[model samples]
Target chain A: MLTRRLSLFATLALSLLLVSGAQAADIVRLATTTSTYNSGLLDYLLPKFEEDHPYQIQVIPVGTGKALRLGRDGDVDLVLTHAPAAEKAFVDADYGVEPHGVMYNDFVIVGPSGDPAAIDGGEDATNAFATLADEGATFISRGDDSGTDKKEKHLWEEADVTPDFKGFRAAGQGMGEVLKMASELQGYTLTDRGTWLAMKDKLDLEIMVEGDTALFNPYQVILVNPQRYDGLNTQGAQALAEWLISDEGQDLIDAFRLKGKALFHASAGEKIDPTSAVHESD
Target chain B: MHELMNTAREALHLLLSFDPALWEIIGVSFRVSLTAILVALPPALLIALLLARVAFPGRWFAISLVNTFMAVPTVVVGLVLFMLLSRSGPLGELRLLFTQRAMIIGQILLAMPVLTAMLHSTLQSIDQRAWETARQLGAGWWQSLWVLIREARFGVIAAVLAAFGRIIAEVGSAVMIGGNIEHFTRTITTAIALETLKGEFAQGLALGLVLLLLALVLNVLLGVMRGRGHQTVSI
Candidate 1:
């Protein structure tokens, strides 16, 4: 009788787990950047992650600012994004627990086949922006606070003269949509080369200019500060951060490529020395 | 001041231009929101109609369930659906996770409760004699239900407006389920969120303006409909 009663209690506990499991997800919400998402890197890497990790990874790819904000608000378990300036500020502000290097890619200036701004010469990013602004080329700015947009604005500031061109346009959309619109309108845009390469098959645009010292784009993965927010899922965020920095995760990043060209260079364990190039020195 | 004014003017021109990207983002938002609302409306109205007119074993419990769902947060709904659609979980074979369909499923769930509860209240608050009059006028059971629906038209519209408002503005479900992918699954709210994160507030601001326009249009449409509804009711 004692044994029977114990078995019944065990069965009841198991049933409770089953019922709750049906209604609740054991997934971790990963807020990240559109570049990381639109490139199709997460879809390739996350299955391996979920296979090894206990929780399913539910990715919410937005802008780095929003991804970090989601972390700041403890709305998501982890963040994968670029834009070192914003990430530094986010880390300094104590919004995210710890930001770790995920990968690096360069931003490219893409434009129509006709090269309307004449920004086609292989000049650096700052010069290209100056030329585009000078020509008032129909520039499609993301207008969204995405890492790419920030970098574009930074380039504009670096080039002293802001262009007074008539054809400036704000897409206020993601990298892919902006690129597609640029293609349709035969305009110019700044995009992370990774997304551009992945979406190249769908566009009539070409890389107008690249090889800018100011074009280096670095990505990082960070956990939300669990201590600050009561709703923070500490274990899940920690798991995501730890996983992205692991050898397997870095390998996946290295393996991620589009059209036989590597999209992002892995930088997880390397020290990012920031002293190489400053386009605008005060 | 001159340069600043020039920059401001450029920004304004950027916003006002009939940029295809602007229309594209709004188009994406409308497609996603309309799909979510249309997918949700039938079930929501059915549940509301049942809750208002029918007496079931769990009548109060059903009402309470819908009320509970009205307050249920979007992320929570995304989380719940994520579980059901994940590979290791049951119904995993469908592989519905991270698709626009999955996002719609999430939004449908999010919008349904608010729609149902609002509709139920509307139907319940209607004059009881209206249903009786339809019934006595040789209308069959389905005809009476249709007349009841027509009589509660304004209330239904209000519920629809509320559902659309709630679903379109929601970022959590769109991000979690739609995965906020560009070119395919991205919506205005999700795009705005991503843009804001990247500090391209201009892009976000543009999307924000569109979203605001959408909200204003919804409000105006509701106002016009409500006004017409009231005028017809008096007649």
Candidate 2:
């Protein structure tokens, strides 16, 4: 009986290996931020991309920092993230190539309906952060070094307030988890508009601040440098990256919506900023 | 290979230097797991004794149920607890979600089945004469129970150690319920999970080493207890 079981297990393992090996040539590993995944953007976009292409894109959703690190370590073929400064550093360091703006969104500060910090309807994110710190209002931070986390830290710095206050919590989690935590704790948190629109119904929080130019979040797709790594799916990576910025891809991004509201603006070929070296079409 | 060596060296440095953040995570793990085990021990022992001694109806069913619960994944437990303690759930008024207390509760539930199953087997293996003789000598029920437990002391200790090992190493429930809040609910396993996600391998490796050392220590203790038990039985 034991011999029979062993043979059965070996056969099963061999079949699994064969199945994976069959598709290994066409696999494109894309590491991206959790916001994009949690917001259900990739779920809507990848299937359409796969319909036309020979490659099957595997999405690994993590914090932006880890996504870029995966690109740097050659663990992934492509990275889609929103932290522009970090993306610039990654490309400048020769870890990634052909950075192109794929889409744009904005971050908003959300808080409980009670508005304990009284930051509701605020246009200035930095000033609102200052108010939250002054009142010692509970604030949940995505401490995972995600794109949203980096933005929150930047706002805190601009507000000239140390986030080490009594009611500040650094939750090392994703955007969805942080939003849920903020609702549960009745705290304030910074979130991208995509995830906020997707999860706002279930959350008891309200958008307290928006429309700040500093809150602009732009996403980019960059290929892992083929020169630094061997065995990379450079062809598939380039295909996906180029396809994302094509007219058809941009149109799909513009059409994708959550709750009957557009979540991301297609910004292919647009300059992220005057200082950024990421324009592909110009 | 070179990067791996550098990370390993950094892990060792973090361990030797006694980094505050690393130690804080270790502290959370011990505090929460210890509280959970302590809270679970007494009821687990009682249930085990009842299952082993009492000839109640559905006794076999009860034993099967416990063994079934023991097989349930930790994440399933976390999911159930998360739903119950969520703001929309029935127990939302208590507001216990995403706290160390909630983690302790999840760990207690996780620890109970293992504790009861192991303890039941240990109590079942004890000679029936030990319980009967104590009672016949006019010792009260509690005293008789105590005598029975004393006879299987090593097995009971082993059961506790084994359960501790299971719960301490479990990451699924702790991450889901504890929320991995820094300096609050972040345990060793959750910290490692977070660090790995953030692409910081040194702290994760350091905590992984701590857990490995803990597993080694528990196994050695179990071995010692087994040897002592054999010596006692031979005598």
Listed per model, the TM-scores of chain A against the true chain A are 0.88, 0.88
Docking class of 1: incorrect
Query: Would you list the clashing residue pairs of candidate 2?
Result: none
Q: Provide the lDDT at B124 for model 2.
A: 90
Number of the top DockQ candidate: 2
- Candidate 2 per-residue lDDT, tens place, A1-282, comes to 999999999999999999888679789999999888988889999999999998999999999989999999999999999888888889999999999999988888999998988877568877899999999998989999888888788788778899998889888988888899999888999999988998898999999998887787889999999999998899999999999999999999999988898889999988776243221111
lDDT tens digits, residue span A1-282, model 1: 999999999999999999788434566788988888888888988888888877777889887667777776678877887767667667778887677888888888888887867887795777788888888777777766678877776777777755335766554567876776566546788898878888888787888788776888877787777777775556766777788788888888888877888888888877654333521111
Chain B TM-score, all predictions listed: 0.88, 0.97
CA lDDT scores, all candidates in order: 0.76, 0.90
Report per-candidate DockQ. Answer: 0.16, 0.55
Proportion of true contacts reproduced by candidate 2: 0.78
In candidate 1 the C-alpha lDDT for residue A104 amounts to 84
iRMS of each prediction = 10.0, 1.1
